[model samples]
Target: MRYAQVYFLFLVSLGMVGCETTPKVDNPVLGPPPPRLKSALKQQKLKHAEIASRANDRKNILEGDFEDSENPFETPVITASTTSAESAVEDTEDILSDSTVVAMVNGTPLFVSDVIGVYNFQLKQAEQRMPPEEYQKLRRALVKRDLKGHVERQLLIHEMKSTLKKEQLDQLQEVLETAFEEERIPELQKGLGVNSPQEVEAKLNEQGRSLYSERELFLKQQSAIQFMAVKAKATSKFSREEVLARYKANIKDYEVPSKVRWQRIRITYAKHGGKDQAVGLLDEVIHKLQAGEEFGVLAKKYSDGTRAEKNGQWGWTRRGSLAEPEIEEALFTLPIGQTSQVFETSTSFQIVKVNDRKEAGHIPFADVQGKLEQSMINEARMKATKEILEELHAKAVIETMFDLDEDDVNSTNSAGP
Candidate 1:
């Protein structure tokens, strides 16, 4: 599957499996927050200034206002500075009182509340399941990961909004809303086991979501998907000759390995009490086989292996794939439609019957041509999509708290005492 298709499916699944809402706490007379919370708050405030500074620095570097370093490979170290204790406290207090802006995509601000809202249920579960330190760590990691996705999504959305006319956008939105109501709502109703649209709405409300919000999300996603699909289709094209060349270059990958379909009656030494008892039991099994009892029936009654329930059938194994060297050797050499004498391995005693075998061979190009061509097209689509995203990133002004935090850490480490 293409990345965009997989991502679109993921979003759809999330919308279908809505998050459980966490109830807000309404306690009074709380003491100071934990050290981790304090640190996170401080970092959040610091990132705002640091991101702007880095943006200006990058702009200056591009404009040749900053001189080139003597060693081009070496990083230009950033000097660190200290903040006043009183100012740091004030910043922390402000963050506690107001929603911190965690990221910016173009001119749009993504608040910390917005980022957390996406994963509120998951974070709540983590807090209950993990220790405070571990939960804090996981929370940071989730934020960083989701923040990247949010940035990319916003970039795509911005591209879609900019590229389409207002009327065209409105038409697209109308089509999506209609489809959601006609197709998606029905599916959601059946999946949720609800009989009415009101029940579906109520269920979504229980998950801190509304039908309007879900519809809006659907509209934005469908627009982005349509834009990417159109872009990818325009760029991804391959000829028969190109596909054939790729096939010939990677012919070994298309080669089929030798395989066998065989059966066995395994008698583990431990299962029968010991090696001596196992040997005795094997003797009885061989006697029954010689008297012409059905091997499958006997295997079902006595075999201790994984396929014992399936009449000891080891269906279609490739050469060199089996861990049991003794069985693997016997598998290829044993004649078809015949049973072998009792064989002993370190852990077990076993007898085998070979049913069928296939020789190693290369797949014909004519047989796999269509699939190969499709695969090549998918690859090209992915590459085209990547290039489109890169172009978008170049044109868009994106800043995230995690990026600033990393920059601040690097600068601090570089500016040693």
Candidate 2:
């Protein structure tokens, strides 16, 4: 459980999570641009400088009915400065300090801002589920663990620059230019001082990156995206039988955990009053039920929970999944269609009725066949992509400026961001 492996999983899991969540794509964004776009790639190189000079022309092209292709970068990301007008003015040239230099990959500086920005990106997925002290410990080590992946990316870019054909690079640069002009500029215009080419260059200068440097970055970023897409496509050619075999080998993944469906009436102890008031509320609910008042009407009126409108009928849930262990235990043991005694649990005083239950079993193969195949293909693609990264990391000379020990890196990586 090295940090390297965790970091690898961290990266791969994003691509795979995307695979699971999104509808089965004919082509993933991580893969290559479509053929029609490929056919239209300009053979002539477009200088970012030339692009800068022709701001109005580029604007025209953008505003033109020349239906732009799907931008691989999709939309350019917002920088720290342009987040607000005040932030843009105050943060314009001050965000990057000497400490911003976190690492170097083959003489290229990797900024603390870059590391933190990337870390925050992952944090938005979910908070790192660790104790406060552990989270602080992991936070210091987070950037260190991610450095290798970033280094590998730079290394791949270096190699791409050296290996790709003049025509190919030119085409890529042109494609990058169009994407910037069309998608990025509009996004940039929404921020400060980016309305024209001069202002755009000024903004880059303030940030210590010019059009040239930004183009290099775009080249690298797009190259990384295209590389993943290409590798994914190559690995995605799995035979139907191979996919089925993969599904068979990992049958546990398709298991339906034994679950219980139950109805509940919860009276909040935390909200209205202490345990006594909660008990009083629960007593009132029970009397109402005894008087033949409907559970749905009672829940919709008083219960503070999901399925309250469905008369407190919580959907089927597997054992150990419920937050309140005692409640789950009570529900499992309670007779079908019979109410439980008013019991004080963690957050509330509640009564329950078991509606239905299901035993643990394998999901029908037909039900999950498409999902299984997609998952298997994505897994293979992720594996191939990881191999590519490992190769790049092996060859890259990477060094970090910050003091972070191997142990901390390992701990953070294994646990993730």
Candidate 3:
């Protein structure tokens, strides 16, 4: 089953999806699992991305069903690669401690397990979607990238600590411990087949996650992301001139495109008529419209395009955006609530009607000030976060043990631009 389908099963078990919207993409913050519980959840035949993508509705999993349900960590920050396949690996207990060290930051040891923990979930999901040869290449790429991510995370935590107040750290640690002990740890214990905290510690230790290390790892990640979010949200407000300058720079975004609420009676040559036959058929359609036979009824009966299902309704379309430029020009010139002259394109003969019209125009900046300001703040936060990560990267003394062959580097480019 697809991850979405499996998430639905979890939702069904919880009886929480009643009329709730299912989000199609994972939240930037929540869908990637936390390092400690990622592999644990995968063992339950569940996935953090599955829950995080739908974090908006799965309130109990993140927050109560309110507008502010955000997962603290988005998958991208951890995976360093696109897939979360590492989460699928069963916790070997000793992988991090047993393997050769991949990297170190600030003289602190970095192990393969740390990188593996972050991506096991991503890897699991990637395997389901890709063929084996490609998956193998991606898995190798993720190991090197996420190994760096592990180091970056440590550096970020080091930077973030200087910003948070001692009291704030205390409070955050309290909340993290409470959540883990009261909720997350119990869920993990059950999933890992342990009945007591000591057994849980022993099992995790066998896998290289002693209780202290697990708590510290969880706390460090949570603190860094939370602090990062705080910095992102603390962007200074834009001045009036700045806002106006932005408005001018992206003026087209605020402008309303010329639009027509319209419908089409498309007579494709192959289905309803051929060549001259298609033109003749459209002429007959126009003649019937002039004779007062209902356009919607005729379209329902004979129109072969998708709009036939909606009585030939195109609803609303913007100029320059329609598939048919000829029909677009004809319709824009046609008066609202009136039918156009019969028009032919390479593929179909169309009889269109303009139900309504909106002339192209810019939205006044005064009217969009609030929206523009919020957008500015969001952009600032993202920029700020990127800059902060880069700065931390520059300051960290880091080392890596792996390098991709040329084929792996080419795969990254081939995967996208």
> Compared with the true structure, what per-residue lDDT tens digits does model 2 show for residues 1-417?
212332343244334332245434443211222122112112111222243335534544565533435786443434332244333333222222224455555445666555555344344333446544444445556666665556557656665544454555566566666666666655665675467867877875665556665565555666666645554444555677887787788888888877899888787777776777777767777789899987778988788677687888878788989888878887777777777777677777777888888877988877877777788777887777767665544444445544435522332112111
Candidate 3 Cα deviation (angstroms), residue 13: 41
Of 1 and 3, which scores higher on lDDT? 1
lDDT of 3 by residue, 335-381 (tens): 88787776767777778888889898999889998889889998888
Each model's lDDT comes to 0.67, 0.58, 0.61
Candidate 2, clashing residue pairs?
31-229, 296-311
Q: Model 3: which ten-residue window has the lowest total lDDT?
A: 408-417
Local error of candidate 3 at residue 191 (angstroms): 12
Q: lDDT of candidate 3 vs native?
A: 0.61
Model 3 spans > 4 angstroms off: 1-98, 118-140, 159-172, 179-214, 226-241, 266-288, 302-306, 321-326, 343-350, 363-372, 386-396, 402-417
TM-score for all models, in order of appearance: 0.61, 0.44, 0.53
Q: Candidate 1 or 2, higher lDDT?
A: 1
Worst 10 residues of 1 by lDDT: 408-417
Native-structure RMSD, model 3: 20.1
